[model samples]
Target: MTEIIDGNAVASQIRDDLTAAIETLADAGARPGLATVLMGDDPASQTYVNMKQRDCEEVGIESHHVDVDGDASPAELYDAIADLNEDPDVHGYIVQAPVPDHVDYREVIRRVDPIKDVDGFHPENVGRLVAGDARFRPCTPHGIQKLLETAGVEPEGKDVTIVGRSDIVGKPLANLLIQKAEDGNATVTVCHSRTDDLGAKTRSADIVVAAVGVPELIDGSMIGEGAVVIDVGVNRVDVSERRSEDSQTASDQSDTEKGYELVGDVEFESAKEKASAITPVPGGVGPMTRAMLLYNTVKAASLQEDVAVDLP
Candidate 1:
């Protein structure tokens, strides 16, 4: 029987664990605050920000939001970042990605105070992560480590193949798994689009993380027997197109009222058959990512407020 890792359960526990620390901070009159700065009106990004705000409210973290016009000048966005940096009420904040192309995302990240960079994308944070003295680990990668721990799938000496090289997931994850920590010490291979024979790499690993953003790129034949599979991609496919591709049944199509269905990089049914454990597209890594962001915000508040609190 294959174990289906429940990210919702794990994330809920993490939130519950943080409640004590949050209360401790509250007692000190330094309740954690997290802010989201959205530059454009991209529907997906807006939805994500909304969900994050709800998570903050659920955990007793004060939530704040700022919106910039889609056609706003880069300077206008920079002003918002500057204000967030100076706001004592905001212990941590993130400028939602996909800012207008005219705005250099890297420059925007650099402008954020490293101490309040809860997203862990700032150059200083990235450098600290690589140096093994990380102040903040990128949320997704850290969440992956937590999931592996909860699933009883230790990565200490296992081969981990991460199928993406984006800084957000791949680069940070590889750095993390190879570190000299309990969740670290894994032998990691980072694969990209140019990599030849991707299947061979995935098939040989004890754990495979599919994050390439391509829907159903990794299938059952590509996964090693008894290996752990973590799917991090959430892609929307038209129900009709998916049905035509034989990826969905008529009943499955009927369940989707939005004309589209969510899928991961790994083909779930096929990969589940060969895997010892696997995370589902909608219920796996997504919740963990949001949960970790809250974790970072709490940590940021603790550090800035000089309050020591236990973290999960």
Candidate 2:
């Protein structure tokens, strides 16, 4: 059996470091604050934003939550973000994802000031990321980097196959991997839905990143021997009757009643048997995502100082 890379333990270590850093900032009379604008009642988004708020408390940072209804007009949403952008107390802010269908989500991203865009959705930050400037990295991909570092699977000179091309993960990670740094300098191949014979590319990788949302997309056969697999997908799927019955803890039983549970793109049990290392879904990249979010928040706050961008 391959080693399980425990992201929760790693994220906890990061949070401890962040707590001390925030104390120093507080001593300097700069209280770092994060403002989150969440439109709609997306259960997953709400949970994610709430966890971020909880993390803020852990690190002695203040978080403001602005909840809007699903039908909130784009103008109303933009106005709220504008207000948060101007707030001196708010060092960074993120407008939660999957805004209502009628709202132009990209416009909302465009409206956020780059300096205050902790999520790195603004084009300015995105451009900076692509230019290899030390700026905010999208949280999830940054979390994956941390995982790889903590696991000692440095990407340098390795063949990394990224199985998605979204601006958030695949595209940015591709740039990050090839950057001239210790954790980077990997020869990266990005595969997507349009890529032919996907397994052929994946089976050759020293590192495999499964960010495509399809469940069990990368089986044991697709993973190269001794490869490090990062499963970034969080897909909700209907559970089997036997599996649900076996998941008998009160909380899990309740979850089964709710219709579906979370599963990653790589099937955990099978992938664990094949890869040299792998990240499990719920406990893996999820917590690290929030840790990297806090990291970005601090970086945004520090931008007011003369510290150089220390991007990896």
Candidate 3:
């Protein structure tokens, strides 16, 4: 039987540890605060921001929600970031991504102060990551690293194949795994849309990371026996029954209302049987992402408080 990599369980463990750490900070007159800049009414972005706020409350971290309109101008967005940058009380903050088409993401990301950049999206933070300096590691990649560590699946001296070459997950993650650190040092291979013979590379890997953003892109046939598969894609698919359900709704004008459901790049059911271990879609990487945000906030506070922390 294949072992399920329980991301929720692992994330809970990290949250618990961070909660205790927060309590310790509170005793010393230090309280960590996370400010989230949410622009637009993107339902998914709102849900993600809400989850981050809820997680902050659970860990005794203060959260401030800065709501802005989707139609807000680039200058307006930059003004908000500038305000947060000057706020000494705010330890860390993240500007929810996919800002309205009008707002430039690159410019907004550049405006955030590197120290308060919990998302690690700023160029300074990215540079620090590449330089092996511990400022703030990108949350998603850090979470993935934790998943591997908590599962006791060391990457060292192993063939680690990662699909997708995005800065957020693939590239930064590869940098971390291939670093000369204890948790990393793996032989890394990155594949993207341009890559040929994808399965040939995946089937030879001891561990496979799927982040191609397409559902069921990888099946059992593409994986090596006993390989560890980490599914990072969150694609929505509409099934027959779901389509029927959407037809009953009053505002269901779209062609497919009831059809979509979150699925990973890998075919979970079939891939599970072939792989030694696998992470499930809904419960995997998602929780870990939020947990790592809290970890980053705590670290940000520690740095501000002049307290040293050992981070991987």
Candidate 4:
């Protein structure tokens, strides 16, 4: 029997653990704060910020938001980051990705105070993570690690084929997994768009993580028997095939009215058959990302306020 990796349940447990930590902070007269700064009207970015705010509310973290016009000047963006940095109320915040092409995203990240970079994209944080002395682990990859632990799939001595080399997920995750730490010690292979013979690599791994942003790119034929499949890609694929293949799934998606439905890089229907365990798209990595952001915010508060509490 194949096990379905339930990221939501694990994230809920993490949130519950954080709730106790938050109460400890409250008792010490400190409240954790997380803020998000969005520079554009991109629908996806808006949705992500909203979800983060909601997660903060759920876990007793204060939420703050900042919005800038898509055409805002780079100076305006810099000033916003500065405001958040100087604001004593905002402990940590993120500048949502896809800031207007005219603005240098890297420059914005540089301007952010490393201590308040809850998203963990700062070069300082990234370097610390790669160096195995992490201030805060990147959220999505950390969430994936949590999922693997909950599923009882230890990465130690196991081959992990991660099918994306982006700085966000692939590079950082590989660095973390290959470290000499408890969550580390895995043999990791990072594959990208230019990688040769992708299927051959995935078929040889004990764990396959697909974050390439291509829907249904890794089918059952590409996966090894009993491999653990973690699909981190969330693509909006056309629903035509799904509508005809599985009416129930198509009906449930309901977003087909917009011409596309959400999907992961791996074809779930086929991959689950071969994998000992797998994570579904929306319920899997998504919830965990939000949960981890809250976790980071709480951590930032504890460090900044000098309040000592054991984190979950």
Better of 2 and 4 by TM-score: 4
Model 3 over residues 102-162: C-alpha lDDT tens digits? 8889989999999999999899999888888858888888888888887889999999999
**Candidate 1 — worst ten consecutive residues by lDDT sum?**
241-250
Off by over 4 Å in 3: 241-258, 308-312
Q: Total clashes, candidate 4?
A: 0
What is the C-alpha lDDT profile of model 2 across 1-312, one tens digit per residue?
A: 797889899999988878766766777777688988899999989988888899998888888889888886788898898898888788899898889999988899999989888888789988998788857888988899999999989899999999999988899899889999887999999999999999899999999999988987988888888999999988888755437475577777766788778888998887777799999988998888888888888877777543333322
For model 1, how does the per-residue alpha-carbon lDDT over 23-139 read when each residue is reduced to its tens digit?
999999999999999988999999999999999999999999999998989999999999999999999999998888899999999999999999999999999999999999999
CA error at residue 71 for candidate 2, angstroms: 1.9
The best-first sequence of candidates by lDDT reads 1, 4, 3, 2
**Which is better, 1 or 4, measured by TM-score?**
1
**Per-model lDDT:** 0.96, 0.86, 0.87, 0.91
Top TM-score model: 1
Prediction RMSDs, each to the true structure:
1.5, 2.5, 4.0, 1.6
Query: Which sections of candidate 1 miss by over 4 Å?
Result: 244-256
lDDT of 3 at 222: 94
Best by lDDT: 1
Worst 10 contiguous positions by lDDT, candidate 4: 244-253
Q: TM-scores, in order shown?
A: 0.97, 0.93, 0.93, 0.96
